[model samples]
Target: MSRHAWIDASAGVAGDMLLGALLDAGARLSVVQEAVDAVAGGAVRISEREVRRGGLRAWKADVSALDDQPPARTWREIRTLVTGTAHAVFERLAEAEARVHGVDVAEVHFHEVGALDAIADVVGCCAALEDLGITSVSAGPVAVGSGSVRTRHGVLPVPAPAVTELAKGWQVLAGGDGELATPTGMALLRTWAGVCEPLPPLTLDLVGVGAGGRDPAGRANVVRVLIGTRSSPIASSLAEPAMLLEANIDDLDPRLWPGVLAGLLDLGASDAWLVPILMKKGRPAHTLSVLCPPTLADPLTDRIFRDTSTLGVRRSPRDKTALDRAFVPVKVGTGQITVKIGHRDGVLVQVMPEFEDVAALARSQGRPERVVLQEAVTAARETGLVVGAPMVSVWAGRAER
Candidate 1:
């Protein structure tokens, strides 16, 4: 799928409003329904129609709240709603977040951003993209206005703590008087926007204007989403993608390399290593290399500069083609284990337990980790483990280096 997507934070975005616009714009109802189905436990009523704004026609989504609603949910509860979405990648991303926060993914409730309506907004946006027949999307730079917004959590600061949290590594322009973006809006965009810099190249197909309810003077409170076609093939889609970030080091503590590698892995680096080369005759130096996802390039690279003696990092993009990949959930001896499965044309080609999860399971079970690992392997061989699943990949932290 040469699909691309983008988000526009013109006059700020709220869960309800964006959902409304997406519904109006023509997002798929089924995808939206499936996403939010678990949040409400049954289903939330919704309707959509083409709406006009600024003399331009667009689709808008209307969420029908139930006659009865659940009690005001805590942050912990909100987290579960998305987890319950049942989509592998979504769930894994939620869980990966738990890993980042040092909490069970299920335990980290979503606060105001995770409410049913917010969930509906996300689902609606997902669906609308499907309905729009938009294979690729490009958005203008977001304008995140300055100032604070109130929430159940209390009178938090402007941009909101959640919005600030989600803005990490994202290029957000701040200029609006107040409330140019909402947490839910940022969350969906961060998860879906494959890249956030200068909009990707594309041939304009149509322009979607999601009107913000407010009418800012001289500026329309409208989020403009451009649906378009790529002028060229999405090469990144085919390559066995890898990122190479290099740095020159001459004056760092040698003792930090191991921790750096561990730190990189913790921070979502695919691979990190050092090359010993003589910078000058008799002057031995090292070239540090970090291979990671495009998304992870910035944070982990930042870690190298901070933890090591590197002054800067240089990056080169790379792609490698490989067979399709999958994941399996296997019933090990006493606990379940997740295995990374690779495939070619629906055939199981390779399987391996995620060492980290296996190690955790073994530690909990009071058995040699290898034993738990072996049992998982055996289970996979016997009748095959659970089918493939997506995972959340994050570069959360770096070890002491």
Candidate 2:
């Protein structure tokens, strides 16, 4: 199973809050400190404290600098100070700031975010995430507080200009009476999270609560981090929620079916097929089904309507589980061919050669396609690649044929 981390920003988010949550979730303090110190030239120090908000306990992170007045930095200067994922986060922040202030990205100077403490918060949080071995990161809808906030530029509207620009195209809501999602927080979310949705199906492994700066009257002013493995019926593996769309058409021409199906597949459908069916009044029909990731559902649905003679389409969300697959090379005559291997629960379940590779070898060597396929399969088996029960004999029979 793949390890994933989800940030619950239901209340709000900030750079320190994220760093604190990562520490609360078991990230090594030394690792975060080292990363921040290296990037800031050992000019900043990190401190942690146990804090409570709305009767709930959490961790609070504080970053302090030895220099009284740290010089403001340009986007290019900051890029040279940090590297890897932290560098990417700053790049996003700089772009958003440039857009908000109507200045060139290279010429934009980070006023608040350029401070040593803010730098530590951003870089340290990224280093903490890497220390935890998280492969994927997601976030819930963000809460951008309603009232105005004081900034280096003076009292600005809540969710400040930079914050608003950073949150473009993301799920956001208004709440609290002050600035909730800061620009640093938005930059982290925008750069780190590939998906913005509610908590998905997962077996919870760890939970971390990070306290914000203020203690609201009734709400828990904190951000949460959930670390876990994806859950599914077949096995504990990496899975994603998808959509399955179907349309029944009895009036379309049979010759046009091939193009319609191909079009759906070409338009990003994970899988597409047509099933023969008998519609009302004993009319012969076909049910066109398309499986695709949720993000592509709308465009692919439009393509279906334009490409086929279907009046309506039905769609439903689906959870898909797939075995871990990889390709291994096997010698076929003088050329090498690739064999696709599928694994379930660390045991191989299926092995087959790339059809195009086998067919190409057959034509080049003047051998029957079946002979080339059989040779590839034999080579795979001779390498002692073992799989689980169901598909073993099935693939073996195909080789013998």
For every candidate in turn, the CA RMSD to the true structure comes to 10.4, 12.5
Q: Which stretches of candidate 2 lie over 4 Å from their true place?
A: 232-401
- Cα lDDT computed for each candidate against the true fold: 0.60, 0.82
What lDDT tens digits, residue by residue, belong to model 1 across residues 118-172?
5567656655555665433334556677767676656656776556666676677
- Leading candidate by lDDT: 2
Q: Per-residue error at 127 for model 2, in Å?
A: 0.8
Q: CA shift at 249, candidate 1, in angstroms?
A: 26
TM-score of 1: 0.54
- TM-score of candidate 2 against the unseen true structure: 0.65
- Tens-digit lDDT track for model 2 on 1-401? 44678899989899999999999999999999999888888999998999999999999998898889988889989988887667767877888888888999987799789989999999999888878876567799999998898877788998789888888778988877799999898888777765587887778898989988899898999999999876653543558798999999999889998888888888889999989999999999999999999999999999989988889999999998777665767677698778887755334668788999999888988889998898998887765455553222222222110
Kindly report which residue stretches of model 1 are placed more than 4 angstroms away from their true locations once superposed.
30-43, 49-57, 68-70, 75-111, 127-140, 203-207, 228-401
